[model samples]
Target: MRSMEVDMIRTLETDKAPKPLSAYAQGIEIPPGHRVVHVSGQVGVTLDGQIPADPARQHELAWENALAVLAAAGMDHTHIVDAHCYITERSHLGIYRATRDRFLKGHRPAATLLIVAGLADERLVVEVDLVAAAGAAGPAT
Candidate 1:
């Protein structure tokens, strides 16, 4: 198929689960053509740059940020094909899964969550990165 120029990539703050809880978007979309995105590691950094002290809170932040990155790239959880999650506390795995599911809403992509020794930032409790793809809708311009 012919590819078109993609434009208008924007991030969305999904549900009101938490604000600035993570550095991610609820969703994203690129216009005109197919899109490929590489979301970077997201941590618990609120809009004000404050890191949540609680690991659970930070984990949510990381996922949120990661989602934001995907939105900026014009993709959402539905478009995600691969993902890597880094966590400091393994016990919080359940919490992470639950919070992540809140956004997924059934769009389960290929993913890997890892329990790490620690993150680069001391305040960060978790980090995530992922890749996504979206087919260009409509005809090429």
Candidate 2:
């Protein structure tokens, strides 16, 4: 079963708006013929399946987990078009922002941050999910 190839993707940037704070484009323009990949929410569990105690550590781990999902789909951070972040406490915003900025470096994709009452696990301080696009489609089932 041969797979279909996707078209190239373009990152949209304009000086009209403030540059993205991290390693994501302000917007990603998917060509007419492109497919989207949705990565599910990822928590901050470590390789040993243990959630960290510090909120900042958890935030970093969550981003790593989400990026791992994109990588599994043969996409890198540059392919990300959007990201959604969830945090249990408002006080963690500063930490979250700093951690995200470090992880993204320069790519700033469309992003949304939400303060929630709690997460699926009480030990989890942050969770992140992403949507990405690549230049190759998947094989048909």
Top candidate on lDDT is 2
Question: Please, what are the lDDT tens digits per residue for candidate 2 over residues 6-107?
Answer: 245555667777876645556666776556889999999998999889888899899999988787777777667788999999999889888887777766
> Which 10 consecutive residues of model 2 have the lowest summed lDDT?
1-10
**Residues 2-25 of candidate 1: C-alpha lDDT, one tens digit per residue:** 122223344444445444333334
Q: List the residue pairs that clash in candidate 2.
A: 22-106, 22-107, 23-104, 23-106, 23-107, 23-108, 24-107, 24-108, 25-108
Against the true structure, what is each candidate's TM-score?
A: 0.68, 0.77
Top candidate (TM-score): 2
lDDT of each candidate versus the true structure: 0.67, 0.78
